[model samples]
Target: MGEGLDFAVKYPFSSAAKEILKSDGFSNITDEVVELAVNKIIDSLAGKSRKRIYISGAGEKEDLLAYVTARIILGYLRNRYITNKFAVNESKKVHSYLNEESGETVDRVAEELGIKTKVNDGMLLVPLPVFLKFTPRSPHYHLINRCITNGFVQIEKQEKKRMIEEAVRKHLERVPLVKKPPQKIISAAKKIINELPKQEIQATAELEDSHPPCIAELIDAVKKHQNLSHPARFCLAVYLIGIGLSDDKIIRFYSNLPDFSEKITRYQVEHARKRGYSVPSCSTIVSYGLCRANCGIRNPLNWHKGRRK
Candidate 1:
């Protein structure tokens, strides 16, 4: 493999990757590429995707094209859940790859993804504005918690890797939705979409209980960028813990709120779990003004267990 193809195969979202792919002029858009894209999505949700998550290891051309094809699939479907899952996983994959790379390579990838930074006294210094732009909803990363000087946030290698993942996610979220995607791309996307299980399996595969109506309503509010009341948020967090959701997954779900602070979210979820708290009873929820319906269940967990919806 040549230098460009090698880099593109490993980092498909990079400029080198785009340039090499453009040189092929769509010649790589074969049935195999489409099929690879479909299988990748299926595997991703199944919790058994390939290590790279974005790139295929078939060969030089297929490896580079698979990433683009997957993006096309996401664009064609226009599903937020699917897009978010794929982007988050792919970005973390980039972070994992960076873990083994030299500091110079990591810095180069950061630059390619548009995170401007400089090295200062053995630390990577990200500009305040640039850091603010890419920091996720996590309070742990906000400048208030970081070391700042000369209008820059000082970071070590590990923090830079994480910030790179957010940068990559931001890039992938803008899936290139063309007026007309290739027929093969659409067909593959539809086939994959059809194969999705009847009950929505979250990317983490742990929201098996999914949501009762009331919890779903709260989720809708969060997704709409509305801030939840403390009571509502506490109720939802405890309910999620009562189910099988890991603390990390619950934190990610809560990250959608308008004013998400990872520090507070982690504390609330962990504190609720440690105390063995249960979801409030239906009557208590009503008192909090969160009960969405008079469903006959006593609690959210009882929504489907010998009870009404």
Candidate 2:
């Protein structure tokens, strides 16, 4: 462990960190390196390590450390000693802004950072640590913090997944999309989306009336025997659970769908209920064309605020 830690500190911008930042697959990263990074981050997050390690060199070196640190933090391996002055200042600004508004969206913060606000693409473009490094302390710090915190794990996972997907996409670009059966492609896509990390839903019966238009649209679709998309179904299940719906009641919502499998639906609902998975975001719902209209809000969880009871 000591040897691995020394290797990581000396090669802080090691090949593994570079691959992760470049969205390259973790093919070249050794288990030792990952273990070291994880340990350091955990120590930092637990406040067990308050010793800051300063790396002085060209901007490239610092950038690499920032990238690795960001991944560690996203992986829930955070520690106070792993941060630099710039990161600390930016983090402070972010926490301050979040404290003030308590409702800022990641898209809004990404927009402020001059990042494109496309669903799942915005935050993944820049690693959180890199973003913090470049973004100066400003009045919008709180908003940025909220966005970062909200999707912290997703953003990191997205970056890695996007890299692999991009590679696959490039390799498959030559393959004709029309050649593949639409149902097969759809099934595969659905499986991937459903399997990705989900947010935690704070189930509340009061939020039912405020369900986002997309979610409401899904419920109507389910009732009408119109087959719901995988993401749509997952969102509905999560939303229902969050709103205090029981597993059996949620199973009934999916009973009429063409692809409905009583066993599968029940299992999924019970899993989500037990694990506390959150519903999809407004951007994600919009990406699927499930969004009914622009509600002037960033998160689907907050959609109820704009609706009239």
CA deviation > 4 Å runs, candidate 2: 1-210, 305-309
Error of 2 at 301 (Å): 2.9
Summarize candidate 2's per-residue lDDT along 184-205 as a digit string, tens digits.
3334333323543331222234
Best by lDDT: 1
- Sliding window of 10 residues with minimal summed lDDT for model 1: 199-208
Task: Please provide, for model 1 over 175-254, each residue's C-alpha lDDT reduced to its tens digit, 9 standing for 90 to 100.
Answer: 76755887898788779878886423223445434577789887676665344667788888887787678999988877
Shift in Å, residue 168, candidate 2: 28
What TM-score should be assigned to candidate 2? 0.32
Instruction: List the candidates' TM-scores in order.
Output: 0.68, 0.32
Candidate 2: lDDT over CA atoms? Answer: 0.46
**Candidate 2: deviation at residue 196, Å?**
40
Assess candidate 1 and give its lDDT.
0.75
